[model samples]
Target: MAEYEALIIGLEMLVELGIQYVEILGDSMHVLKQIAGEYKCLSLSLAVYPVAARNLLTEFREATWEHIPREENFAANELAQVATSIQMPEDCVQRIIKIGKKSLPSILTTGMEIDVNSAAITEDDWRNPIMTYL
Candidate 1:
């Protein structure tokens, strides 16, 4: 079973239907995470999938990515497996997207290599919380 083929095909249809951002949750961390933009997929061919996947993102004015646990993606993976086993046509699998939800802005932001908790937003900046009222 290929990875991008499913994601790209599904996303393409969504894009045509006016979908903006897309959140794909799954254990196929390899594909789901990368396409979600949570991680970089550095390959010339993969990157060239098409601007169509990107252009739709612009319609929303922004795009982002995140990774959710495998449990959340259970249904999709099951259906995908069925599709692959049957060698169903691409159009048939596209129907699975009907269950997809409108993409939301990823709440989990990417972390920095070094996340030192500076006094940037700490209470220690002041003697006491009440003192700030002064």
Candidate 2:
């Protein structure tokens, strides 16, 4: 479930960036296979993630998913661990941002829609939400 959530988040970021091509690499064969339609998502809790991922894939002109060894996926794994564990100092100048777990997929969230056809974004564009989230 964590893998799927990460995959969906990555895909959403790519879409917001207007990237037409993408190659996704992960260590989870089960998640990749389910996204590729080679395996069934039998768990009701996990079913929405693959569907959301597949829908995001359609936004790209070309997209591919590859499974790498766990050792090769160390960088992303380490990043995830750091993101979850890091604490901000109270006296720091920068404002502390908190992200809460979502009960629904990001696509179902409202107020941050990107225009896929519009290649250029102005300073006050709708991309503000994504930019802020990032």
Candidate 3:
């Protein structure tokens, strides 16, 4: 159930980025089966998710869902656990980026295309008392 929420979040991120094809890996066979139309989603609470996710899949040229053993999914599991512990500050801008094995790239893209580096300021900016007092 929670796994499908995570998967939905990833799919939403990809849709926002205008990405058209994706390969998704998950350890939840039930969620994958629901997405693949191999099983019926019987839970009233979760019945809507498959339809919503499938609508997102329609935006893609191709979408593949695969199941992997939890032991083989250590990195993602660890990262998700770690993510739940962090609190975002009120002024924080959130971005979602997909990273492959070789390179680190910025995830700060949105419909408005925020430029994170564009707001760079001197050390004095961080020390300004008036701004800090607020």
Per-residue lDDT of model 3, residues 1-134, tens digit only: 56766666678778878998899888888888998999977665566667666766888889998898877988786887986677667887995544543111111121222222234446579646765687
lDDT of each prediction vs. the true structure? 0.49, 0.78, 0.69
Cα misplacement distance, residue 90 of candidate 3 (Å): 24
How far is 35's C-alpha from truth in model 1 (Å)? 4.2
Candidate ranking (lDDT, best to worst): 2, 3, 1
| lDDT value, residue 105 of candidate 2 | 56
Which has the greatest TM-score?
A: 2
Give the top-scoring candidate (lDDT): 2
Clash pairs (backbone) in predicted model 2: none
By summed lDDT, the worst window of 10 consecutive residues in model 2 runs over 110-119
In candidate 1, how many Å is residue 115 off?
35
For model 1, give the RMSD to the true fold.
15.2
lDDT of 3 at 121: 46
Global local distance difference test of model 1: 0.49
Where model 3 places Cα greater than 4 Å from the true spot, the runs are: 81-134
lDDT of 2 by residue, 13-122 (tens): 78978999999898999989988999977665566677778888999999998999988888786887998888778788896575656555565562334333334657
lDDT of 1 at 51: 30
How many Å off is the CA of 97 in candidate 2? 11
